[model samples]
Target: MTIASENTTVFDAVTIDRAVRLGTATLHEAAGRIGALPSQIARITPGQSFAGPAVTVSGPPADNLWLHRGLLASSLGDVMVVTVGGHHEAGYWGEVMAVAARSRGVAGVVIDGCVRDSDALANVGVPVFARGLCIRGTDKDPDGVGGVNEPLTLGDVVVYPGDLVVGDADGVVDLPAARVDEILDAADARIAKEARIMAALRRGETTVDLLDLPKETR
Candidate 1:
């Protein structure tokens, strides 16, 4: 499903933050627990964990001119999500961009390519997720692409604009727009149930007894 830019709405930062605080596991389990198809590309910069509305970008591999332009055009509180056609050869994000983004009130960046300047990024406190770290630099020309606010494939899943995205130590999960409320409710219920189970465990209840499993299963 290709989402058109005109149809895409970048959600408010408050909304995304609220969703993140709700509970990571609940958001995942409610969304059927589908993980991002790509494995471990995003590195959360120390002291830079954040959730916000997505500003999606798409461009050619190994080029980031468009990304630079996107940064300039992105609004405050937007999380710049760059899809570099899964290019992992060169670093598309670096300390310079992170600094600029922070000044612009950008939430963070999620790139399908690579990033560099890890120490600087950590020091500057900008969260970044990428395929990996690479010292290889990207060309500013010949590889520039377009930014369509539409739903673009990141890793293995289609991320629609305005859909909730929560990323923590566990991983990133894309929440379906229609199911956000339902998932939040489910998460609340799950938390309540877990609380009771935790109390029982504190009282020396075994897993079998807490879960009501049979002796044969235990």
Candidate 2:
């Protein structure tokens, strides 16, 4: 079984709200594509979405002993960023854990493995993101070293605890805690620019001219 560090520093709640508004796609771009989770990882439910500082967990493959410990260690507004060393078959999480997470005000979960009881999890009400679903259960032996509140490598991305984690229909992306403000500023500019483009579209402006492309005879 794995465990967590004693450190509990979290990102600002207000900043998390602001980043959530930007959405994963926007933050992905704003962060220069440096922190997006693997593409294979997707939301278990269509509308599940949230943003917060991550509580990173690295567990043994095919084992969930670390999951329970991670849950106990998590805090309000914490997003569980679980790395299972790419174990994609076993269902390491399920409905019961969802309920446990919600009781503590945990925002959501993103696992580099599978989660079961999708239907039952709906009742628990915490957003979950994972590679997919599985019916397999995990062994309950919390008897090994696990990493919590530490940096984790999940698929193609590396997530650090306290980094901003955002999830939406587009998928989950982690933004460095230190870069949150800078990226939010960029996201705000992008949003404003899109508003102008949308207004131009409603007024019948062609994409060619709106983007200042050189005029050409077709």
TM-score of every model versus the real structure: 0.84, 0.91
lDDT of each: 0.71, 0.84
Error of 2 at 216 (Å): 7.7
Tell me model 2's lDDT, rounded to 2 decimals: 0.84
RMSD of each: 3.1, 2.3
Tens digits of per-residue lDDT, candidate 1, 1-218, equal: 22235324455545576566765556677557663536665564754465665667777788888788778656676667778866778988898998999888877688878889988888776678777789998877743555646677876788776566666555556676666667767766777888999999999999898898897944
Off by over 4 Å in 2: 1-4, 212-218
**Residues 1-218, model 2: lDDT tens digits:** 33546436577778878888889898888778778888888999667789888898887778887888888889899999898767789998998899999998999999989999999886677999999999988776556557778888876787888888899888889888888899999999988998999999999998888998979878
The residue pairs in collision within model 1 are: 3-150, 3-151, 41-130, 42-129, 42-130
